[model samples]
Target: MAPPSVLISGAGPTGLILALVLLQNGVSVRIIEKELKHRIGSRGSGVQPRTLELYNILGILPDIQKEGAPIATMAKYNPGEIEPSPSPKLPSGSSPPQTYRTYPNGLSISQERHEEILRDQLQKLSCSVELGSELRSFEQFSDHVVAKIVKTNADGKQVEESTNFHWLVGVDGARSIVHKQLGLSFLGETQEEHIALGDIAVEGVDPRFWHMWHVPPKLLVLRSSSSTSKVFMFAYTGRPEHLAENPPTREEFIEEFYDVTGRRDITFGPATWMSNWRPNLRMVDTMRSGRVFIAGGSPFMSPSRPSLNTHVPDATHCHSPTGGQGLNSSVQDAANLGGKLALVHKGLAPVALLDTYSEERIRVIAHMLKVTTELYHKMFSGAGPADPSAWKRGSDLNMLGVNYCGSLIVFEDAAGAGVSSDAYSRAAGSTVQAAYCAPDASGLVRAGSADAPTTLFAVFHVSMHTMLLFGGDAGAHAPVATVLGRFPEAAVRTVLVIPQGQTAADDGALFSAVLEDQAGHAYAGYGLTAGELAVVVVRPNGVVGAVVSNARGIERYFQKVLV
Candidate 1:
């Protein structure tokens, strides 16, 4: 009956997902949006594999897979050329089937539909976005935030209300009030190029391929929309002054489309949404200012203690829409902060855990900006679409390689062999390292039941940390049980994993569940040999919290994370 502890500004994917995570963890949340109605557009449509894994953890992967389509092959048309050349197969679009991954392909779904799915999930959780309600301003106190909210009434009048919450998060886009009020330095450069983007129906283009054209100093792309037939997401890059002076009208977009592509056969329809975007590559020096945080297109916030307040803002960082990392990164920002916020709110973890959100995200965001900026330059460098390097996307863009290695909170008792120094490069050789994205291993059958095989991802929960004991026998149970007894049973789920050819241990009384690695996929995925004793703690957010050798290491790792 009491008011929600968290106030989230901007009901976009970031805020909605953050609220979902908090609510799932039994943390109350109030989410608000400045927009009177949900916007319509196919913006930021690329859903990377890493994001799909996160969606799986949130119990929305089924919906996403149902509603989304695979990334379309690009059909490139050079200047004065009518016949299109298809882009070479690239690893960025999808990964081949592997035992260590579930969702290997990148998905293409409209941002509108993505947010709609997230909103639906929030509704099921007994929460809804307060539309037309804006966070006008907020003053952060030591323990709470006093926010001034402006609501637009049906009569077109604005009413102001003052409320207090334990935490405030801004998911409001680049011009976030939370970021402005917090006075964080948005350090980066604005590129000279400008782009016009919109969603429009087209009559003549093939729906199977993403059409692109390159004329010197001008580039245009029309990607098939996944959710709507005959509708395409349009993007045109041109001179800054030209795009700025000319608004994205239907007629103007149509004319530009023909002029750039040299295709008069395509008939353009009314645009559903349009925007003139400039590449503003910027990020906050710090994601938190006392009780305020920014995220989404910007920064975010969190509380340090039960008595303290926190703020998270949307638009903490904004970059070029090159690698499709905008929406994906923003959602990740929420995922990272949500678990910490929930723990802090419940008095289960110290407020210091909240600091790890900024620490982990800032490093990733900085690298992300650099990668996207490079990709942007490659796309518009006046090289024809035939330049393989310009169009070829590496596996890094999938975001499965993103990790929080070297984070203060993550503990690795021994160095992982063959781990890459550049943690953001690729997911292939980094599974055993702490702070990496947790790997998925199939062919895991429940103890004493091999009728239906399962996966490690299938048993992972959203609100609990999973401790995987690899190759543990009956003798190992006593020490593991003693260490687990020190923590709240509900907060951690212990699972004993038996390798192939080994007998299952009677650990039902000690562990929450037991899994048999029927095909050695579990051991292989974790970089362990058969019968090797190991402890791997997977955080609720699907990150490897620790890679330890014994029960003592497990205690040492959790001591830094939990209260």
Candidate 2:
């Protein structure tokens, strides 16, 4: 059989991440963008905690932190009132710490800069996106997909080409040609909520706060955005009866701004970009069709017998930018699908392994869509609570709780029973469940006489499955060593986490790495007993695939994933 190759449509962050991860794992990929040039402006500008963790694994968190800022505090105002309303006091109380996370809060960075980082990462891997190249159509066979493509040259000439690939992925926006070609229905309603939004150079506006006014006829907002000079993003949501069909011109925007804020003291400069946004609430039933699959905004869904087809996962999107999760969710979708595809390409797992991508992500997206939709209604519906406390950030938006608890590939031994996903929190430190991302914990590795401290986050392997053997005594370590030897070297890895005061050495032949639990964080974080031996199998995507007590359990878990 020919080696697996992939063709991805769209050069947005989703496609770039999917391509980058696939290429890093030695898979061949060709990515195409229909746009003539790179996109500009802050479209989906919020990066969630879960996405930050994914960025850490991809080795791009440093760059993202350098280029982004924290969420801006929203300052409220009323029409004809020059002074701002008092900042709503948040409920005074203490809650459980969010321990399952490293990057706790969401980051605010424009979508354009996010894509630049992804493209740069892809370039470092010796892969680049082909601009002005579009997927016109495709036909999928039992084994491969033939795609018809059109490319625009430097001279503005267009050429057509046809190519075949082992799989096809569509990350194109909502109006996806691939989805249309597959004849999938985008079954949902588009709301009447319309807003005029734009990026504008401005003066006399504080960058630290997101300014807003709940006027009679409309709600107006202004927040800082990264630009050549000081620029702000403005959104004007007028009454449904008064919204214009076309985007407002600069002159009209200035007049509306003055009327709403009653602040001629603030000056509005030229608009950098502007658009009319209509809140769309729709999605396809599934996210795959034959050998061609779609993710992000493509509304193509998988058939009932999805195990027989090649796979890529999906992420949901909404028209309203209530919470900045659109791009973050899409990147996560790519992360999950890319991890599975990498294993399949390496021949360590069968193609059936790809089926879980759709199964797991569909559940996540379904939950997310429901949550975001509820928030949208709560905010826009005239009946929404006026208290700022009512709109406070919650655990749902953080995305740290997303998991594949019921996925086919994840197996938990009897010891793991009752340790459900809800019990697996960084704050709880009582249980860590299978099918969720492994929690990071602190430990120490013996170096000569001195012990060096480290963390579970640092030891996670981005491209290989990490097998953490707790209670790393001689008896615990022996079974893991034998199991590691049985699997392909590139397929699995072993990290022996020993108890306190135990001297451990890196025997390159046996353990990939050895660490002593000098701090007991690993023991507590993973909810393991110092007296009992346990093994945790974490997938390339950082999700715990299984938790078992013996070597027999380890072998059984691998049987489900490996061919």
Candidate 3:
């Protein structure tokens, strides 16, 4: 077969997710990791609600839900207190059922398990991560990238190989070779404080709430990772000079825990993984250099520097892990780029479409850095642990409100002109708007069938744009159909959403599917009323790209996105 179109360096969640999305779109991909084996530990364990929605479209939500646990509530203990004191509930904790959202709460699955699920999905597509294979260097041409890769053989001998691909993406963590070789500037501040994190076995702690104890200038948190096993994720901030070990010894961790909580009964076990995390508040000025790109592990921005372009990494952009946005933001970066890259590689969209990746992500990442940094300050602001506001996670962190409102590619008709462009300002409310995460609605029954009721989410495909024509007159369908016919059938899927008890004259042959909004959820989720006619285009990444009133609107929207 011909060479894969994309070469992805680093098989972490970002690379794996990008590879999966590209493969699903029929774009060939090769993913490599410098590590000989998969990394373990519950790093970035919080999978926010927005990420869960994306996972649903990727067809892995079931596995994630099955393997992951809900975000636990905090059980705060004051100094010398054994029993927990009432603590402020995190925004990620349990909540009332949401009418517009399918997955309303954050999940607690370790990064290792998250990657396992993604790798399994990719394996089903006949692709696998090449472990011990590292992207040593790469040179980008106008149309292709030549990369030198070093692979460690079974006997541990290293072999060098040179290959070419249409594009190269660096998801290789903070120290991204791609970002460096591309000459991108990662500008940010390195915080003075340090945090120690580890996954260790602990006995006598309840495996329910996230246990925490505050001893002024120092705080210790032990969050349960398993109900049956004794493993818990431990995080320590403000380590004293005497106990300042890089990877704290088991005895040191135990001593700190005992000193903070005064729990002499609690015993400690061996630690599986440990790290001394120093916050680096940085981001890249650019995210792309011709055919080469980067995502995840680094923080990135659009071009402001002359030398280069930029991920969720220290390479492109990196910040404190306060709101669990690093991994999820990295995944979002991949999701936003994968579809556009696939379309461009397949010659279905203009190469300029790829530029929007950096444009769209830079804003979101900037706001994310601000929010997470604020949370970091609040957590360590000399405020006692009992200060509920210190631990409070707002709904904005859920990322559902994250939007590409002012994106050059997204189009909002006059009907949606009232929708806010400021995602950060209106993040807490549920308002459907253009260039935002596509909301899910259940209780849709396919036309002319008695099959089990489905959902707007159930019909969304990762490989194509889903054009939902909401409550349009019969004549309106033909013009939209004609416009959509200009695009590849595989690239766009058309669905007709009608009000409950409405019957169409045809079997929806002009559309790929006809969904009867049995419970009015389809209209409600899209902020439309029954009998209202509008066209909503959900992009391959599950973002609402356009909210228009007619076929001309659909045409205008795609013109901005496709070739």
Candidate 4:
């Protein structure tokens, strides 16, 4: 049978990731962007730890590390002050035990650079974004979606194209044409306050820190990615009517900057990008309609960064970038949806699996809107964190705690059915639940091969479920393997996690791969004793699908999707 095809709107990080992941799973994908060229800005700069884990699976961690930097200290300045208040340090402790947390901190990189990396990864799969191509409209039939696209030529001519796709995903930003066409209501309110925002070259200011000037009813901020660049992102809040009545000019912006900073030493350079924005909190009640779906900021798109004063003036801002959850949430939305779609396309799972994408993601987005919007209110209410005390970025902001415990696809064996959803009660640093990111345990080596050491993360694949059998002794792995042997090897892979002294040779042909946990970290991380017999089923999206004590449990878990 011909592979199922998917059409994705928007070439931002969310769309790019969805396309790449689908392609990796042998699904055909065509992605388009409305922009004439790639966008430029440092809008969503925070890459949370959960997102970093996803990047690792995509094999783009090296690129992310090269281009991204950690969040710098925030330097607070009161209006008319020369010397800035002492910057506060980020809350620090060693990462939650190495077994549970691999990337404990978030990284900061401009949205433009982040998209460039995603595009590069997508290109490796022999696909590229179609620039100047817009999804004008699409009709969803019971079996397929017919989409009409408009493209602009270099000669300033327009061409129309139409295609049929088994699935259509809208990762387009706020005010998404796809969402509007699908009749999804973006339910939320728009704040009255507006913010003036721009990226510009500046003189005589250090870029090593994020600078903020606090004034009543207005907050000014200047930040740069690195010290070597003269370009900094500048923003200050105001009333919506004020900007409409007296549209800002270059001179006016410079005057406002001086007035807010109270420093004559700093000079403004040419503006690279500038706009005024009003924040809006909005979301769709449902993310999918038949074969047409919306995701990220709204359903799976990055929250309207432009509307929140990131890129464009007239846009939707369902979420503020205060906690840096905007981009991270968007990436996760794509990741979650992509995993389900890949399985359905490959025929390993029924189409019903796709329904869980909205079920799981809507909850996450709801929680995110609450946290980020609260931060926005705090900042605008003059009750935000002050100097000598930074906005404490806690574990919640890192996104490690995001889980889908209530997801329809997730199941728990009888023994694990009562494992509370609290992180404290679960294994160290984890919430004992099915729909959480599986912890990574290091000091793992293949049995008897003596190859380079590996970690649990090294074994994760984005396209299939991983079944780990706790083979405490030489004879405990066979039954687990027998149950896994029933499934297609490509859809469900079986691995035996054995103690250091165990060998694959002991298991004969029942188990093909044996992972030796040298320091017993894998056992401890999974909350197992030295000789406990258990099996863990990790879903394609990195959620722990089930933890069971025997073959019956494994059969029950696979029955959910694999017939």
Q: Which candidate wins on lDDT?
A: 3
Model 1 over residues 202-240: C-alpha lDDT tens digits? 998787778888776777888877735688888787733
Candidate 3 on 1-563: residue-level lDDT in tens?
A: 67898999988788999999999899899999887777777667888888899988888889999888878788888876778887777675333233388777888887777889899999999999998898988888887899999999778999999999999999885466786687787776777766777788888878867888878888898877744457888889878886553556667778777777778888887787666666778877777778988887432221121110011124456877777888888889999999899888888889999899999888888888888888877887857465677777777788877888778888878654525546554323344556777889989998879989998877887788999888777787778888988988878899989888887666378888888988888787666765557888999988889888888999999998777
**TM-score to native of every candidate shown:** 0.92, 0.89, 0.93, 0.91
Candidate 1 stretches greater than 4 Å from native: 79-82, 86-99, 239-244, 298-314, 382-386, 416-421, 427-431
What is the C-alpha local distance difference test score of each model? 0.78, 0.71, 0.79, 0.73
TM-score of decoy 2: 0.89
Q: What is the lDDT of residue 91 in candidate 1?
A: 53
TM-score of 1: 0.92
Q: What is the lDDT of candidate 4?
A: 0.73
Over the stretch 319-341, how does candidate 2's per-residue lDDT look in tens digits?
34565556766887788888888
* Ranking of candidates on lDDT, top first: 3, 1, 4, 2
Q: What digit string (tens of lDDT, one per residue) describes model 4 on residues 1-563?
A: 54339999888777888887788788889898877778777766778888888888767888998888777777787777767777565443235653467888888787778889899888899899998898988888988888899999667689998888999998875566776787777777777666776677888878777888876655778888554567887777753354532336667778877876788888887776666566777767888778887777721223223331334411222677677777788788888889888887778888887888888788778777877777777667656555222365566677776877666777776445533344212233333346667888889988777688898878888888888877455556667777778888778877888877766665745665678899787887776655667788887767788878788888887777774
* RMSD of each candidate relative to the true structure: 5.5, 5.8, 4.6, 3.4
Best by TM-score: 3
Which of the two, 2 or 4, has more lDDT? Answer: 4
Better of 1 and 2 by TM-score: 1
